[model samples]
Target: MATQQTSAAGDAHGGTDTSPERWVVGVDGSPGARAALVWALAAAARAGARLELVSTYPADFYWTDPYLLDTVRLDEIRADTAGLVRAALAEARRDPALAAVPGAAEVPTDVVVGGGAAAAQLVEQAQGAQRLVVGSRGRSGVRSTLLGSVALHCVAHAPCPVVVVHPGAVQPPPRVVVGIDDTDVSREALREAAEEARRLGAELEVVAACPLEVVWSNIYSVVAPPAEETRARARERAEIVVAEVLGADAPVRLRVEDGEPAEALPRVAAGAVLLVVGSRSRSRIAGMLLGSVALHCVVHAPCPVMVVHPQPARAAGRPAADPAAAAAR
Candidate 1:
């Protein structure tokens, strides 16, 4: 079994009852990880949710063979991981944004250290969490345009919505942006984005992109529709989606762009506080693969990206996996 430790910060509401809504964050002592911790802290404070900080080390390092185990090495790794989480929590608590929120400094927190693949450990910790936050990249990250393996895995497998925060993402104006299309997942994304915007008291912007190049042909010289007509039709479709999801009188600003969705979304959401996108997958197997637009926004967006998955139906009598057992592997 995996060694574990837990701690709680002072109560935020002057009570002992822990909030049922929990937000789990992965900490790896990297700048990106620290950014994610800070974002999660602020979000938890706003929502009055309990916060859990998790860190992990590779179990393979301390497992010499099927029968032999390096107990001393495993202990050292656990201790180091615990220390890293503690430091991150302390630093995040001191953030001005978190402190700005009422009682944010006193938000309850827990720390967990496990041994296994970092992504699996995080997914295990976030089993019942309201949201899972991870950095777009970690210590092993190389290019800025690429997401780290752990973040990608968590986004694909976490049971709840996943928020990926880039290390250099700045605090933008109070606005939430969401990309939408004719798909059902996009409607879910719009709803999630509207709710988030309401929670943050931010303006909501619904964006739809139409790639006109798809209408053009190379061999037959097919004449594409006029740009204005194409844009008008695109706007109409977006408006219909917005009206269906959020009513006709919903307070949302809609934008129709004449370009690829992957490129237009990030450009339009340049300074927004959060960019909401939906995963175009229905089952767990398909969930492992993100749509091209969603994957692009997560990697290239200038603000925190929230990838909302359609809630899956719960399986009756399904047993939950043991995190400790998973860590021990």
Candidate 2:
């Protein structure tokens, strides 16, 4: 079982029938985790949401000694992890960015330490959370992979949207970029993006990618349409989609680019504070959680990436099984 210690900076904001929204953050004392903590603090403060800081150690650490269950060793590991979470919280309180957001330094917070895989613990803790924030990579991350295993897993299985922040990412202008298509998931992403922009006091940019390619068939070789004409039609379709989802008078900047979605989204989102993408439900292949485009953006986007998963109904059931339990089995 995981142990948790809670601390609050102050009382919850007055006047609310329900409990305050919570934003869960995964911390591991890495530079990447620190970046994530900073972003989460600023966001939580802006939204008046509580922040939960979580850290975990491998439960299998005691497996070498099968005959003896060392409770003392387990307690020491938990204490160390708890201390790390507290240290990260302290540092986040002093971050310049958090200070910039009024009252962000005073957001209420809780610290949770678990004995299990980091991703699983995070996913479990993020239940009913407004968002789950994590570092793009952690200390154990391989240099070659842009995203670490834990971040990817959380993005895949967490019950809420997952925001992955890169360490030392350059702060961009106040703008939220969201990639959209005709899919229902994209519509959800657009709505969430609009809300995020409103909360952050940033402009909203809606982008659609339209790739043009020749059709080669056994019976006929169809040449690709003119670039200008193709672009114009793509723009028209994108405009209609945006209008339908966000109404005709929605205040948003729309852009249609000619390229694959995976490529165009990240390129267009460059220098943006946040890049939002929608992920489809798990695929037929086991352990495959996100679509190619969403996965690509999460791995390559210049700024923090927020991946919104399909709703429960659309997912055909609840979120995927607890990653920690699965790993244990």
Candidate 3:
């Protein structure tokens, strides 16, 4: 029983350090964990943060297993856990992309044998981490039991900025796709997207997905212009929002489309690394009946998505996003 320590440690690429700056990934025997290992190694190589690969399981079951009194059962569990960890590590090494990472050879791996709940353990490890990377699915849970339970839990409550990587989430020559609208939520999304694009050294793309309103005014149609003009106006409005959130100097490429928010984002992110969207602004009654667009994107987007809560109007004078507060931690 290794005691849990508050102090953090790094991996051996340059000799593990005790700084709280390491990049962490949670690995269980799931497809998502395997993807997370690859993602973590690549990120560690890029960010120069040591990789911390950890696998956690319930320890109570092991200690209380009366059947474990049979030496066979005890040994079997030990062997199974060790094999799972070893396999995960080996799978990571075999990935051409991850194995090719500059620091992949030096990334140290560790196995944590204990259990409260896997999601809780992973979230605990995420605290103080530079970033928390996890695959989209894991062991089952109570409500979202049908989806990737572990990823779902961590996204809702992890202390750090959590990135849930789905298998096909990574895009090439990446672009940052941001959903925009009239509200401050879209403003926050724009700001976050710009920052991420800078981090990944990619281009920022600002997009607005809206439904066209039709009005039957004969005189208005005779003098009014095409829908393209309306779209242009919407685009200009989005540009103002983008500028407000990202500042005049923020690098951005503009795009406007007419479609459902959910459909538009996936299409725009086809070759992008990430999609940033604002949490849906739903009335209490509406939210209970149907989930918002942001929630849907988290579950189904072709790429990783970051959902930001828009600051209240009263907070307009405050900083764009406080790094510490922006992260749930």
Candidate 4:
């Protein structure tokens, strides 16, 4: 049985309470979702956490299909979907990597079918789960613009940390990379990333994309340039940020580069088990339009990315600071 524990309230978005024994994953038969299923099974085995394969048929999937009026056919489709989910579990059982992990065979698997949006269902189940994993479409700039909608929503709203995996990601005991800045949000991002690294017995790499010197600023045409010592001090400050915010003793390698965050992050992300960053909070007006960097990474990294936001500190309390407020400075 999946271990029973009280989950954080944010768990309404698939964030579940995690201990040594409880883990849950949302799955569908999509290649990406199947990959997530396998990943979850392997993680469950290694951590001795219970696993659940949640498959949802969102109302939208049927919006364009009129055959649903045929009850018999609808029933058949549901049965077929259930079979596919079962097959995925069986495949996980046969995987060599899963078998090699200690106590994997003892891991329990569950299949749940829900009627709602995929993001909503997944997040609901995430309550009480240690972490949530999903597969990505592997799209990037220009050619495919935005992240897959489901992934975007899940990352933005998940109650617990979410892992959006890519095909053929490296197995566990891997390095974790987090994009850090001087903001409190980055501190929260670093803390979460460090905790994950510790749990996985992985190394942690902290990276920051420092702004280049304002050589061409219209108002600074006559201003003196920063000294080498000034730049060095900024880098040191970044390292100190990581050291102070983590609140735990863990070795970290810090890197500071000059470039845009969107560009710099991928360079660090290459070949890492996970890349974590904080979500840019949006204003009520802007929110009507789109999210920021955190939303973008949800769909497109070489590896899984965990987008951390400062969860409201109290249950049912207003957020302590504006997500935009954190980003402005």
Cα lDDT of model 3 by residue, 203-251, tens digit: 6788888656566977777676677887888888887886676665555
Candidate 1 shows a clash count of: 0
For model 2, how many clashes?
A: 0
Ranking by lDDT: 2, 1, 3, 4
Ranking by TM-score: 2, 1, 4, 3
What are the runs in model 1 whose C-alpha is more than 4 Å off? 1-5, 9-17, 65-73, 144-148, 168-172, 214-223, 282-291, 312-329
The CA lDDT at 225 in model 4 is 51
Worst 10 residues of 2 by lDDT: 320-329
In model 4, what lDDT does residue 232 have? 76
Worst 10 residues of 1 by lDDT: 314-323
Candidate 3 — which residues are off by over 4 angstroms? Answer: 1-10, 13-20, 59-64, 67-83, 107-113, 139-148, 169-172, 182-188, 214-226, 280-290, 308-329
Candidate 1: global Cα-lDDT? 0.76
Q: Write the per-residue lDDT of candidate 1 for residues 1-329, one digit (tens) a residue.
A: 37485774443444354686888888998888988988887777667788888888777745456433767766776777787788778887787767566766777887788888888888888887879999888889665445447877777778888999965444555788999999877877787787677667677888999887553456443566667888999999999988777777677789898789999999988878899998865444533454577778888889899988776442223222222322232
- Model 2 spans > 4 angstroms off: 8-19, 66-68, 146-148, 168-172, 214-223, 284-291, 312-329
lDDT of each: 0.76, 0.77, 0.64, 0.62
Evaluated against the true structure, the overall lDDT of model 4 is: 0.62
**For candidate 4, lDDT tens digit of each residue in 214-322?**
5666677446556555457667888678656653244677787676676678666777877898875633232332535665555456777877756545212422222
